[model samples]
Target: MKKFTITRILMLLGLFLISSGIHSTNKESIFDNIFTVMERTSSAGNLPGIIDNAGANRGAGFNGRYVFVASRQSGDYVYYWDVTNPDAPVQELNISGIGGGTFTLADLTAIGNHVFASNMVMPGIFKIYHWNGIGAQPSVLIEYDSGTARLGDAFTVMGDPDDFAMIIVSQHGGKSFYVWAMENGELNFDEPLVVTIDDLPANANFSRVTLPDGEDEFPVVSGPAGVFVLGEDEDIILTIEQSFFPGWPMYVNIFAYEGGRYFAFMHVKDNPAANVMYVLDITEGEDVLEALQILKNGTFAAKVLHSHDMGSIANGNASVSMDVVIDSFGNLWLMGFAAGNGFVVQRIGDAGPDGLLLPFMETFDGEGEDTPDTWLPEGWISFTLDDDGEEFNWYWSPGPSANPNGQMRSQSAYQDDGTWYVLNPDNWLVTPQIYMSEISGDEIIELSFKIGTGAQTPGFK
Candidate 1:
């Protein structure tokens, strides 16, 4: 009496795939709502919801039941959503006064009852707000300012007391704001603990990132707090890619208390050459953290899994500066803000060297997870040269297409920030970097791809 349709069955199968932690990875339609979750994996059925705010979405935080978002609107406000039923989330509150006194949120993060947000003003001020949970009125609990800190970023809530947060001052051309921690709900007129990098007693501006073996050397003196210094000589290591590399991602874990010790993960961010994960052991107590010791067996932080394109503008993004959360079930979820870096969830195996990831290929074990091949490997990149030979720079759009469907299909970079990198109408739209990697014994190789001008316009290459 009933006919089962293949399309219907596939839709159900797609949803099931998400529950298994492997969602869609389509980047054809920007802001088209391909995902209902943070991972934004593509799906024909799973459409995402968008909240309208001019400019860019700075930061977002999830406290189990509510999704607090900070997209600088006309005023300083933090939007909270009732995600009790994620299927139909409703904006329950628009708590303004985030960065009170004409300042707006530059970034935000939250856990349990506390939500933290900061502004990019000269003094570098951050405010914390607390709520009684579902459908409750939120109020400013505490506000702090570091007069010397600038480019305040990665405002993550350290769950030790569930009340404090660590702010990374990403100031450039400066010695950089070091490791600042705040806990009490009040401010002290005296200076807070500012970790000064330029003045380290060792006069050590740089060090080998991976212990005892790594060779790549990057500037460590200036920029953001990617490296968590442990001992006197910067000997033992736990750090993300330093901020000197513009747009390079830096993800650090909230200090976790495990086996009578505090630990967090850092990113060396190398593959095929060095270990990507660096496990850290912070000293006990929040106020005083000694030099961390690298745990050779701590493999949880080294699992390298790739997500779909972050869709950042200008292809300026090499890393997705994600926020790390290691769940109780031994699952690690790296969450991204609404801006760039889509969320990626991975189940880490034993605590040593790349741990027990489900290896899809033999060549990539204890190294990193293998990325699945895509139809268009070398994605689009936008390029333009003026008559005088000058190149066009980066420009963000409201949406690459008609509306903000959140897709960046044809740009050289996987940019879905709504900004189209426009070149001279007849110049060029270069593709991503591509080079031959191998020659088989037969010395015969074939390349295949699909391309269309989408127009019959002359000189449209």
Candidate 2:
């Protein structure tokens, strides 16, 4: 056509690209949108402390602006962070000496102001701590010493508004549940409220707990690798165990209470060879019934592969083992450990039935980055979004660029004055945008992209 310089044509195309990207400009403000998470943690330096290798810890919320985290670096101690500010989480206090002689690294639980933590050891020591609203350090609330008793590994603590909180030990030398009571962090009950396979709806094949040689007992007392509590209801307890039992089978069991009968999903382990995970459901009563056959699911449980095998990856290493939390809007956000994998924030609650995922509140790596690299390894990271209750659509950069699909849409996402907010698009009728609201609000801000859409699509698949 007419004589147009390359620069002029490129400018026109750029403007058109920007214009086409703008769908609409209409806007609306809908408040009362809140999200919930289960567990979250990060390396040292995320919080304020002279302690090197101190990581960010997260769990269910408590009080006003504090969170219960499974502290990583410091003997897996539990610490409270003031998240009222959301971004700059400052350490309010710390709890230590929960039983193990060495560094305690495991899960933690909290109800109201009270907290609990555990580590791997025979007759392991389960420690408790309490935060009293006012300025008080989290002191040792209680310590449940497993002593020489075959202790459960990877233990988790859960409590209700009532008096007792159940400590679900994945490997209690047998199929059993330890129930403990807390009178402001003090263990009120003496022994665990033992729920085993023998007397319930079924019988647990604890043969793995005993060695084949017969000389030594293969006590099911290996530590619970992980734990999850489905609300405060006495309905069901989701426990994940990592033990040498049954040939070191990593298990995921769901002990559900229905009517008066207890149904269980027993003995799940990840197969290294096939890169797959096998899960089974069992029931308790006169005999331990294997309800479901071995169901094979994705083998992403192993962080080594999940973080490395896929292009877009998620790392839920909150030290709590895949802590999946369903939010108020029914979005499931998992907070645990995310190392070199930046795709975690992108997926958020993408696993639910309706293409929705839980919203991530915060993520960080202690000690600022040494280099300004756009990756997960070098820096501390965290994110919070205004989810409109819609299954957020994943958007890539420029055109067809590869980026992890996140939970929400954006109208404007500029970094100004350090505050991130969504703004109405330039021309779209209902356009939305996000930008930094306050520069000093969130400590670590990360933005990344991937290549594809839908769960079946392949970018991080």
Candidate 3:
């Protein structure tokens, strides 16, 4: 017999036992449902006349009931709109005379009542302008001359303006980025910490960085190569490959809704049909690194909950700003800029209910007739790293006579036209999200499954 190996998975069962502790209520994740609430094209003429300039609108910021957009041309101005009614955003304020000179404005970020904007006055000099309110005059908060480094491609600020905050900025053509800290609402302009990321691509323009809410350790960076999740020590922990994006990832943001967290990004170049935005649920892992690893390597596309295409928008230089409002209910909103196109707004709906209930089971017996041989179980995802695309790593199989029900098996070896080939598969089988919140304190959770290998032979290793 030609020796080979076949790994079989019989069934997966989750058994739950009742505990005496009280069952706490859980809020649903907002990323589960997403819908576009409003989108304004540049041709709509609803924005200021300066917005019509090519590659003008760049960065976006959200503070209270107002949304701020920065334009780079005509006159370096920041425009504010009253989005109390998101559908009808009334243009309100036009901030001009920033830096007291004509410079190219790049990006804008806001936290609470404070808004900050960046401008690259020249190849080696940049300034970060700050404003306390809509009526306040902007001032140069941090001015730096890097000699030869192109500064202020994109940046973000996190935390409260009246309290502590941190700002992250990217060098347009350099291998490193810069960070500054705020102590008691004052920026530390003496010296900014410079971090050089290894393996960062050369000449990668339009780089953007963002730190997750309440997370001061990990900062997610996006560039032409891909999206990298940096550890507290500035080491690259996880990377979402560029192949997963429709174009170069221009912006990335992490937001928390209810008790769950999500990752969102937009491409620098828009697809022919529209500019796309992707969101992945990263709530399972204990921390951001583990959650991203699970989403990138393990669960794969199973956790990608949303991908919205804003129609025919030209994202000259894309940017995304997220905010939440709570009145009688919680509302999560995303404000984005489509360079040549106008502003786009989207809302993520509540996740309705939590994930699957306890005592769940999957037998892999429901193979559809359309693909009887390679059918996958519902809610189960399978992916392979093989570039050939000719073979699947896992498939449905009819078991032996003694166990004829069905089985999920991996492809280890096969023969084609009398030529025997040994297969090495890099693949993953990911289960759907399971809600474990019901388990009370000190309660033990158990995972059990049966696995066996078919075709045992001495020659097979």
Candidate 4:
């Protein structure tokens, strides 16, 4: 047997320690081989209109499925797509109601075999669908009667619809906070549960549901531009710490349901121009519940010279904007304009808020700006797979800049399958390229990407 010197053994141990840290990041790498591409395949076919916020219902245990707002040309209704098989997903249902008037609604959620959706328009409405579980056809149930004032624009349905305390959050005039619930499919309109706040409107630029309250709690908050949930059933209520303050932040809020009390987190920042994210803690007066935070990255569109504008459009429409998406793993993925430079993804770890972290991430130019050169970026990102903790597979989405030939390469330590793949789209397409690989476990790892500018392409290879 070959022996190692003392120095060599120490080096091996050092490397082992570093690898251990990487393993600690994830117990089992969820992304083994499943890939999601963000192509501009909007079923609605319309760019998202100006709205504070919208999202699919989480109550419907349909995690890992694509549920987003969609509209039809024939009539106004929200559409749901069974995107589990993303490569060839099929529309499962067309949700509509009386008169079939078009609605600007959020996506649907699944509860057992039932799905729920909401329309935040005035006189907001909610639609329920029952799935037999055998087929994709979703049977429409009678709309839940939300006894809210006819001053709706930005609202959301909280809690499971099948439950007795199915609630709806209604904001009228950006000041009034109304909570309504349906019992036996009938709405109790006369008993208007109002949340009183000092000075603010009925609606603001942003809102969200953090918790679903119990039978007695009716807590809520409204402010110039912040909100948070107070409590839920026996869950802790979040109290506003005097130390926690919002200094002219754009839009931030928290919502929760606890012990008949609806907690709202509202950060009142005095400076209108100051933009920052504030963190809040939820507790039951004494016992700390959980750590929650609201980050606001508002954008201000600026007018550039006609020549510069044209150049920007020609060079891939670089206006410098940012957006955030919370992934299945509860990771907040932030992308877009970076300072006076390009763009990057801001990664946040599962730790307390005080120790905020920021890395150089990445920087790119107009590398994969156009078709034929828009699938992968050069030295942009690399992916790998872990099988039984023994061998790993690695691959990189190829870019024209890295390999002008526009190709991708993949390799595995255990398998010798020399296969390289490429998928391309023409024009200013804005869909992420997805890739999948199989490991020892039954689960497959997936990678979803939106590559922008650099010496590489902009999609998956």
Best by TM-score: 3
lDDT tens per residue, model 3, 333-378: 7766555556666665433226222222222322222323343344
Give the alpha-carbon lDDT of every model. Answer: 0.35, 0.31, 0.57, 0.31
TM-score of 4: 0.36
Candidates ranked by lDDT? 3, 1, 2, 4
Total backbone collisions for each predicted model:
22, 84, 0, 54
Q: Summing lDDT over every window of 10 consecutive residues in candidate 4, give the lowest-scoring window.
A: 303-312
Please tell me which model should have the higher TM-score, number 2 or number 3.
3
CA RMSD, predictions in order: 23.5, 22.1, 25.4, 18.4
Determine which window of 10 residues in candidate 1 has minimal summed lDDT: 359-368
Give the per-residue lDDT digits (tens) of candidate 4, residues 1-461. Answer: 53332123223433112111111122113222212322211121322231111222111123223333333233344433333233343344544332321243432333333444444444444443434342444454435444444322333343334443334343544434445554443444434455433333234323333222221232333233433334433121443322334322212222221111112221222223221222222322211122222111211111100000001111111112222334444443322221112122232333222332211122223322243333443333433223332333433444333445644432111224754444222212222233333446777554333344442333432
* TM-scores of all candidate predictions against the true structure: 0.43, 0.37, 0.62, 0.36
Give lDDT for model 1: 0.35
Model 3 weakest lDDT span, ten residues long: 5-14
Deviation in Å, model 2, residue 440 alpha carbon? 34
Model 4 misplacement above 4 A: 1-64, 72-74, 90-92, 96-113, 119-152, 162-165, 182-206, 212-224, 228-461
